[model samples]
Target: MSDDAQTPTPMPTPNDCDLPRRRSDFATFAEAIDYAARSEKGLNFHDMRGTLERVYPYSEMRADAMKAARQFAAMGIAKGDRVALVAETGAEFAALFCGCIYAGAWPVPLPLPTGFGGKEGYIEQLSVQLDSSDPKILIYPAEIAEMAGAAAERQGCEGQSWEDFSERPDPETDLPEADPQDICYLQYSSGSTRFPTGVAVTHEALLHNLYGHASGVNLGENDRVVSWLPWYHDMGLVGCFLSPIANQASVDYIRTEHFARRPLAWLDLISRNQGNTLSYSPTFGYDICARRISSQSNVAERLDLSRWRTAGNGADMIRPDVMQNFVNAFAGAGFRASAFTPSYGLAEATLAVTVMPPGEGIRVELVEEERLSGRPRDLSRPARYRAIVNCGRPLPGMEVEIRGEDDNPRGDHQIGKVWCRGKSVMHSYFRNEEATDDCLVANADGEVWLDTGDMGYMADGYLFIVGRAKDMIIINGKNHWPQDIEWAVEQLPGFNHGDIAAFSVETDNGEEAPAVLVHCRVSEPEERIKLRNQIADKVRGVTGMNCVVELVPPRSLPRTSSGKLSRAKAKKLYLSGEIQPLDLAA
Candidate 1:
């Protein structure tokens, strides 16, 4: 009592109001509606010009969403029912998502088909996800209505475009209130590289993450965000779309296609609109800075980014040099190093896991490669090391632990599997309890933690991601499962014996497709050149994707400290831009 009484309790203030209500139960659709209504600014989507289009005010969006909910209810989608949404980003996508929530149906947003080998490959993937999700209804955009309808027909599900069903009457019936533990949505990771797995997030989980991110990142009604990341991605959906709405902020959204074609438009939009908070593709967007630096004289003097607060880096591996280059290029443009927040997150954690706190600058640790790859090391000795950016500490109410292969907790700076458990943790994989159980493991203390499948360790209370145990490759901020690419190349004649290594390289442009370094054991230079072209053509044909192929002498590929081929190390070599290319006839 003497010691306790000596310490004074801190007084709660306005910032404390930003803190979330700590609870186990999830907020229902009704709660979301109420929150939107209570927000002073209301809800609307802005274009590149910052022209606010009243897609729906807080009340109208909710009412429209509820009406859509009634339509879904008529289709037998009740509370806990699964509904799939496959559409581009627009007012309809948001409305359908909210409608599913209001109907007590869980929404699973699928990636629009792209980069597939062909239409057949696209159809195959679409069928696989549709079968896996087994939703009651498939909602799609009018433009892609025929393809979606055919896919749904093949899967024995009803499909309709928004235009077809938007005018349907709102069944004026009150649905059952969703419990906090109720599953909100199934976020599918980009299956660019492997079969996409759906992460089942609960309503409570999303609310907690949204609250932590909004407050921690200092986002509020005053902040305006302009985003081009597709809604299919966790960063785009959570960080750009939902977070803004949750924080009572305004958001400006441009189509991903438009941004991809006109990268400069992103900056132009930001400058023109005076958007304060935003995100971008690290590789593709790095070009924006380079183009500005080379072409636009006195860019820094011309633009004002002083109002920008959080420039989050995630969805792909963060490149140290890229960040440095961007900072140097834009130094005169009012962009500060302190604003670069290197972050780590996955689909399983409702988008954000660890965010480097704002104003911390970029905290990175340079660890010797030998020690990081599991070689026995002397920690006390000073040695040359590779630098890895820190993803900061866990958010309030969340706990993180690094565990070894034996499942026991690992000590500081020891690489192992990253595991986490919190209010934002997902409930289960939709319908597949076996798969869910494999991911969500129970520890001795009976706490269920999600296995992130990412390899990383903790040091001095901060988390550092090394690589993935699943062999996933992130190119240009897009996740491409390595096995998928390998499968595409393995069909070629000369690519056997694992002669092909597909991994990501952090180029100045952003993370491009894994540089396909092939070890074609041919001696003749001419034959090797021909093989290289054949392999490249095969990869493109099978995956309908473009990748840089480098033919090196046989046995040139590097291996991990554990005798396995190291993609991370190979990527390092590729970035140096010294890998000799075989002169192949185009």
Candidate 2:
């Protein structure tokens, strides 16, 4: 294991970064990089200790990518062939991704374990993706080469290091011509082992989203992106890496593992950068940063977030309290609440679906609980409300709709399944026609729409997500969003995200009832019972149903590759008797 396992190494920006403006005018990623090659500033890499590991300019990156393209051609890899890459936030991976584009092959960015899962776990996960992608070539960093090799061997695919992939000469023939409809890459949605749905995005769809994203955020001449998001994810790959190239702007990079150890390094990079900064993170990311720096004093003096024009929150439900905590903790350093840009998106739409316009900050709307659940408010009972923050309007080319069960659009404040239609929407789930037909629907006017599988409402054209529709618990015909239950239990003392998984469990009597799996740190029998009872009470109060709370050991719940708690996996594990409850008597 590397020392980065213990201590954080901060990645600093290079001196050569000239901070360019949005010079976007391209049809495909290959064209975008070819244009970027003319610029001095491009992708850069930094170590965990704030050191500039590599300053790979766009020109050099393009050259390196071409060399990789030659290697692919030499190996008889045809255009449109799948090439699996274990995405490591480095210049090498960036170049390889571009190389796939220039070579006319579809690059599949797979996740590299960052200590969340052990070696065997990572290999298991990698092998699944390898089989799904069915790539002829596999390239990974030296750090995880053994695991990568194991996965490759299992899949009967050839593997090599990034160095080996790029060390060869240029191909004899000219690079293949790329069309706007050519596939840029494959992004696997959550659930690798159980259900790997690889979304196939085209150059036209991706570029359209990038243009809409720039216009959606009102991107300016001086705006620059600073990110530590894993490239395997859409936000990290499309939003940070490809968008910067298409827009001709320079971006700073750091490994996600480094950011995990020292989240403050994220803000530090933002604070130190002189250009207008744009960054994004999930809700827990902000929560973790605030709590990590709580014990330190003079944070204001040490940090300079005044230039952070847009701090985006997405990839999960935006937590208002966590956002407020971040603002309160950093207000002394000139961080404003208005800097927050709450947005809603998923990989199926190729990243940006909706974005908060510049200067809107966040607007929390308190809708009646009944109205939220598609029921009229009962004047006879005290009306309850849920605080949902506005996720702004759809991007320029994207359309967001709140559709009810009948597949018709719902009115304002009526919660329903969220659907989207746009130029950026993916063509289909690669090689899975049945899954594609299930979600991708065509309208009467011949427009294709994507079923986001998310439950949310619309107010004044803004979207407010409640939770996943599949995760919603139904008891006695009324809809109970598991997010509400999990959130209510989160309000309990010492509880946090991933500590609880709420789902509907079938009873022996053939009735579906809400059940909660909570991680209990307290080993004392009495305290465990007390905690479980308290959780059940809180859940019952919010969900209007009695919940069976099962206490398990801490860190027992399953999480997705991106580190989001996987309720589906947890439910499967619990039902299979895999997650044994902590020994305790009733």
The digit string of per-residue lDDT tens for model 2 on 356-408 reads 88889988987777766655565776777778888989988788998988999
What's the lDDT for residue 39 in model 1? 41
Report every candidate's CA lDDT.
0.67, 0.83
lDDT of 1 by residue, 1-586 (tens): 7765654532211111233432212265357555654443333454544344444455556667777888887767788778888847777888788888878888888766553224664566567778988888888888777677878888888888888878766656777778878888887765211236677888788989887766556564346676777887787887776775566555566766666466555665566544465554543355345544666677866567676677777765565656787778777777788988877777778877887888885777876655555544545644535567788878776789999989889999998889988887777766777878888888788998988888789988899987677665644334454544554565676553345678765456664666688776777768877777787787665334677788776656654211235565566565665445555442
Question: Model 1 has how many clashing residue pairs?
Answer: 9
Clashing pairs in 2: 9-48, 9-49, 10-48, 10-49, 10-50
Q: What are the TM-scores, per candidate, against the unseen true structure?
A: 0.76, 0.93
lDDT of 1 at 169: 64
What clash count goes with each model? 9, 5
List candidate 1 segments past 4 Å from native: 1-26, 40-56, 191-194, 273-275, 278-293, 376-384, 472-515, 518-586
